[model samples]
Target: MARKLNDIKSDVDEKRFLFHQFFYKNIDADIEIFISHLEKLTKVFIFSGIIRDFFVFKNQKPFRDIDLIIEEDLVLEEIFPALDFKKNSFGGYKIKFKTVDIDLWVIKKTWALNQGQLKFKFDYLNALPKTTFFNFSSILFSLETKEFITGKDFLRFLRDKKIELVLKENPYPELCIVNSFYYSDKLQLDMGDKLKSYLKSNYTSKMNVESIQLKHFGKILYSDEYIRNKIEEMFTN
Candidate 1:
């Protein structure tokens, strides 16, 4: 019931699918609270892996958290003042309420991060990669539509895929190394030689070999194992 890259974009069909996933699992109590709060927000979207996990596959792990992106950072502070929220080194705010850790991310309009940059004009899609669904990061369920918007390469996970690296502005450093290793090990795909050099020269060079060894391959054994299983299921059967 999910939309593919080639599917016609229609609000009616999309509303139906969102409703389907809304009932696929008992909505996490905290997420239910978050959804109820959505009526008060403006230009907000839930751009997390969970939407894809529930809508496309319906085989995802039970609720751990949800990531929401809002147009205004100040409005969030005003809305959820009672909740404990902290801005992290990454461009996101961690809002904890009961069992839910809702990541409140602000969307700056500028696609590229640079000094003296004016916000309120950037597209969120530019930050995400054109890789497999595991790395296809912009699966946003906009509150305006009440449905998910698939990324440009969402269906490429079903094919022999190529990764395009426009990473000079990439904010998530972990993806450059951890995800590169993940795809190479599990999917028989290598980080294209250009990105390999870019990573080595820019980010990966600073780490000690042991640290790199542990983080690059270690996240799979720890938090990302389910992504591995889901990938296997999608690629195999």
Candidate 2:
């Protein structure tokens, strides 16, 4: 059963336990072992989509990928000496396990934060939420502490099943626009006014469909016509 927002908000300990349980059960056994081993080296966090999916679908839906934030600066090769890892364009390391792919990076090297696109007065963990494009993708689960760190409106938006733009100024506005529609459709969530307006203003004929495809590793979810019609419907509605 999906957890109610009220119940989740009411009990932090239970929610933490549930999050850990969901993560351990759903993730591949080998990947779990990798994460456990990595945590011994540095503070690691499981962030964004997977965490949100846990709240929305629990163990019902399979996870697409895992995003990890490492608190300490360490050489990836030193830690995973035997495993093969590739560097992503955004300065993260990508490791593909048997069933799922993992993206790991130092918290300070987060694209938006590293480029100064997003600013925070507090630490990286606190600033992590502000780096996301959507409120639902802004929560993080600490692998070491067994706690959750959520952004503003994270719970409220999740409860409403609404997709709201949390960070408007992003390095990849086009990708963010594509993700807005992608997540909205995939999660069966409604788009908020801010996101609707942003999409309307930022979407253009020159938008690179090929680039979007490449970002998703050539996997096309929504067709060009489908995305165009969806944006057009946004304006009409």
Candidate 2 wrong stretches, greater than 4 Å: 1-8, 11-13, 214-217
Provide the overall lDDT of each model, using Cα atoms, as 2-decimal numbers. 0.51, 0.80
TM-scores of all candidate predictions against the true structure = 0.61, 0.89
Residue 79 in candidate 1, Cα distance off native in Å: 2.6
| 1-237: candidate 1 lDDT, tens digit per residue | 454545433432455455445643545666666656754665677664565455444445655677777665455567767768787664677777676577776665223332223232345444433222243353566666565555554443323244434334454455554555554554455444455555554443343433444753453342344434433443365
Compared with the true structure, what per-residue lDDT tens digits does model 2 show for residues 105-155?
899888778888866656878888887888887788888888888775687
Best by TM-score: 2
Off by over 4 Å in 1: 1-20, 23-26, 55-57, 89-91, 109-135, 158-168, 172-175, 182-205, 208-237
